[model samples]
Target: MRDLFMQAVAYTSMWLAQREVFAYRDEALQNWTLPGGVEEVQATVLAKLRVALDYARSSNAYYAGVFASVGFDPLTMRGLEEISVLPIMTKDDIRRHRSDFEACESMNSHRVEGKTGGSTGQPLKFSMSRDDYLRSVGIGLAGWHFCGYVLGDRVGVLGGASIAKQDAVPWHISRSDLALNRRQFSAAVMDDNRIAQYWDYIARWEPAYLRGYPFALAELCRHRPKGCAGHYRPRAVLTTSEMLTESDRHIIEKALGAPVFDGWGLNDGGASAYECREHIGMHVDTTRAYVETVDDAGRPVWDMPGRIVVTSLTNKAFPFVRYDTGDMGVLAWRGCKCGRSGLMLTQILGRCDERLNIGGVRTEACAGSWLTDIDRVRRWRIVQDGPLHITITLDVDAGFDKRASEEAVTLSFVSRCSTVSIAFVYAPLPLPTDGSKWRSVVVLDSARHQTRVVAEKHA
Candidate 1:
């Protein structure tokens, strides 16, 4: 009865909210449309960008300083092409001035707190209002619904949050709003025993959709109990967090006997992009977010690959205007045949910080192409210490050609970092962070020779 009442309330609230959004949609559709028709969406995004810039300049101290440094007037900014004039904000900038990121109103009353965590292990804290939280969730749900999920469908989420301590028995399950309709199993504490227990729980519940970090789901697929396939088959498996390698997708799809949809988002609780049934590339939510790709010089790069910058359209409580997410990808001009009009993200190359420093030269897309290329390798990590020294860890079949593989990897490294020395070693897999997410690459300064295991299998 209690669950039914809560469901009713959820349904009613969603209905009312959707009515308002649809009203906005109808009015907006008179000019623009969903999936973001290029010309119309571009116009909408430009207008929002101007508004967001104005809001940030006036309300966010961090952005105010940023704009002043670049000598760019937020009000007078014209089209996306001129975005190069604005200085690019990186993760380091946010970490150093965490307090300045908040809107003045929020800072004065302490109405919200800020939070941050991306490919970079450095976590940040920020603030937002209750309304901001709800809006974020609403936009996320809209994307899920676009991918065929409904409000009441049971979902399974495998993630990491420091909610429970390690070795806790019977893994406590809570009906918190944060968990929503999903049964969440923390990958942070994953072990053979815990994963077996999680599988038993999943068999009993038989959720409709499975969603979580790709690394965890891939680990689960690799180590699940034999004959467990008969118990349940989710309609689809959605992967997020870590880079969804083709091997990981293959493992997950084979285990669940279902299609795997890839998604990209941020801790700010905004859905940057989601794959439709077509599965070509993720469709950007142009109505509520504006995304741009910029080069290292912070200059906008259109019709080419570059770093991703996102500005949230909503979230007046804590504006994320022109926030550099540190991710590298391209905004392709092509649209999907699925009929959605939002901008399309061609690819998400790893994080800027995740790049391996081969000698003095930095490298990107190493993990995706090399470490994840071998089918038998379930998990791996690469740590670069200075230009000369590096280590490679692997979780793989014992029969793997370690000698040849190492030589090939060394050759690749030499090609990228011509004068650097290379080292390779196989170690026991490490564990995921508190969020059940994996790090593909970790950079270590030569001054700090501290050996830290960085990657793990996420069962």
Candidate 2:
């Protein structure tokens, strides 16, 4: 009964905010459903751009200057395709113009301020309003509902964040205005024994949904306790934070005996895409934002893969217009059979900076197929000793031909990057940084002082 009342209150508050802040969205979606076709989705996005431009021109100084620099008259910019004319904003631009990003007048002095985890090895700080916070939470909960989860359903979060360690120091779980629906288990401690203990606790909780970083979840699956394997059957498992490879997804779903869904977004923005029952690809949130895939030159790419650029329609607090998220993915131009009218993202290829270098050449391609084909095993690194070398480090697993994996991975690296050297080493894999997420590919070959990926950490 209490849960129902809380849910009612939350929904009521969300509805009021949706009407107050996103009135245009309400009117637009009145006749439309959660997922719409391509044309409808594009039209809705244009409508959102119109609304966002009005708010941005009035309140956001950053965008005002951006508009002036780009010589874009937002009023005359007709549709989503016209967005291609605007220059793409990089993370460096945001860092340099941090003050300009904020909607200073709208900021409440008491709101919480937080920094991103730099999971892509580039950290960023962004602000969120109380209402914005609520909206984000609401969208996430709604996505889970699409996958058959309810308001009070037990959920487990396996991600990294600073939480109070319950050792001698007194701690308190503060009851705040924010709706804290799920129990969080920290993945900061990578020790196998401690992780096992936490997994045991998760089983005790018997969560309906398991959600977190793909790497952490993969690690848990690798060392899953015998008795706890099938006992804690979750309704679904959702992977976020890192790219969900086919192998990892299959492993997770098989281990948990539930369908796994991928929810994609950045901490700076609210929910961008969510998988529906159809499970084809993520359906873009056309009501709140516009997404475009652009080539390296910032030109729009249709019918092919490119870097994803997103422009937020509702975030007056921060203008994320034409922001390059540093990730690569293909957005499907065709409509989904699911009868949804939102944009679809077919594939999320790794990050732009996570490319492997061979000898002296730079390449963003990988040779090995998902899990089953283990032959392409090679020692690889974006090594910066003095000059960037595609350092191939090879140690093949048993039963698989190590020599073949080495040859394939090495040859692929050589083909992409001409400056390469083969170094055969039988050593343990490099450990990821403390509290830092690992990318399968690393770009900082610091030995030669080539800093391709540069985003300063906040501390």
Candidate 3:
């Protein structure tokens, strides 16, 4: 009875909020998997691209000026191949001309704001129309469906996106979350005790899907209670936000007793690719955004590694044409084993950023993210130059607690890699002045003794 009630509430709320997503999701389920749907999908993409170009040229000042500067008109666009003539857009361009990117009519209207938890440590903020937000939600739901998830299904999300830790409670659920059958588990510094608590919740809740960062899920698998495997298994484990490696996948799948499905998407741009059951490669959702790979000179490449570029066809309010994602991967025009046709991001070679590999356990430097909440901590950076040595640089206020902060930072890393040593350095302001994005996590190349100094703008 309780499950039925939650389902009713969830679906009813979704219908009231955005019924169009369901419609699109249904169409996607058919078009993405059908044998002859590739041609139809391609036609739809070209039609949408044409409409998008026209809309942007008239409604967006930025694109209009860009088209004028290039002496290119949207009317002359004959094929998707012709899109290459337009200049590529970069993150720096967005940062410099954010206002001009938005549609002139939506400047004063209400919209949704999106900020990416960038891997390079520089957050990019953008706005989306209410309609586009709803469609994106629908598109994401279709991806979830590929992994055997249904609407209103219970999901245990273990990520830093939303911290749910209370003083006594390891996990928290709000009323809305309960209605939607969702629970958030904090991805912050996890020790045995915390992992045990998280596992306890998962065992009780019996979520149909486990979704979160691969690194956090692997930590949970590493510390799960003995004899816990095969006792409780979610339908599938959906991992995103970080690169999912084979080793991490093996660890998570072994402990959870379920297959791991890797996903990649841009938070700010809404372009996505998800793995189907066949698991050959992630099928790109070309219906929402146009995705392609490019060489260093901004020319398209195939069957080989290059940079990933995207153009959001759905985001009319903030149009992004040929936006460089600063990530490297391969885009193949091959068919998947799942019968889904169109484009597939065959490989994700980027975002395999440096990690702290100590005592045979590798972990991300997301501890620096949690430090932002510490009292008097203005900014922080984590640098790993040796296999067992880590230096944390803190730019803090006068009231900072050096001993307590060190203890907190130490616990975060030592809890994962017990053999590593932690040190601290105080800095007033050490940001680069030559206009370069700074990364919070810096991992030096021990082979050549070269430090990859990642910049972080002092706030």
Candidate with maximal TM-score: 1
The true-versus-predicted C-alpha distance at residue 176 of model 2, in Å, is: 7.5
Model 1 C-alpha lDDT per residue in residues 66-163, reported as the tens digit of each score: 78887888668677777677666655776677676543546446245556553366675655554445545555666676567766566777866522
TM-score of 2: 0.79
Candidate 2 Cα lDDT to native: 0.61
The candidate with the higher lDDT, 1 or 2, is: 1
For model 1, the superposed segments whose C-alpha errors exceed 4 Å read 1-10, 13-36, 61-71, 91-103, 107-112, 118-121, 129-131, 162-172, 176-180, 267-271, 371-373, 401-411, 417-421, 433-436, 447-459
Choose 2 or 3, whichever is better by lDDT. 3
State the lDDT at 123 in candidate 2. Answer: 81
State each model's CA lDDT, in order.
Answer: 0.67, 0.61, 0.71
TM-score for each of the candidates: 0.82, 0.79, 0.75
Cα RMSD of predicted structure 2: 6.0
Q: Compute the lDDT for candidate 3.
A: 0.71
Poorly placed runs, candidate 2 (over 4 Å): 1-36, 102-112, 120-122, 162-181, 357-362, 365-389, 392-401, 411-427, 430-433, 445-459
